[model samples]
Target: MTALVQTVSKSTLLSVVSAIVLGFGIITVAGHVQAATLHDAAHDVRHATGFPCH
Candidate 1:
């Protein structure tokens, strides 16, 4: 009985950690893509118009 309880606790801790790591990875990747999109748009606008940013 004691062994079973220990195993369950360990499994629960592992599950929680996995969930947190996955969440962080997802958030970071999404933020990166959003930043890249904005950067591309700015670059394109500068080329499209001869007016320089003062």
Candidate 2:
């Protein structure tokens, strides 16, 4: 039971760390991308989700 608990804890920790790292990486990359690109991506997403951006 103790080993199972340890394994689960380790897996959860790894998942959390991975998510944090991926989020940070995306933010860093997005910062470097062109504003037009980001705007177009956002526009596409809004339309795709039926948000009516325009």
Q: Whose TM-score is greatest here?
A: 1
Cα lDDT tens digits, model 2, 1-54, are 678657677779789889999998885444434467675767655556554344
RMSD of 1: 12.2
What is the C-alpha local distance difference test score of candidate 1?
Answer: 0.59
Record all residue pairs in model 1 with backbone atoms less than 3 Å apart, i.e. clashing. Answer: none
In candidate 1, stretches whose alpha carbon ends up further than 4 angstroms from where it belongs are 1-8, 32-54
Q: Could you tell me which residue pairs clash in candidate 2?
A: none
lDDT of 1 by residue, 1-54 (tens): 678656677779788779999998864444333465644655545445542322
List all candidate RMSDs to the true structure: 12.2, 6.7
What is residue 8's positional error in candidate 1, in angstroms?
7.6
Top-lDDT candidate index = 2
Model 2 has a clash total of: 0
Model 2, runs deviating above 4 Å? 1-8, 32-54
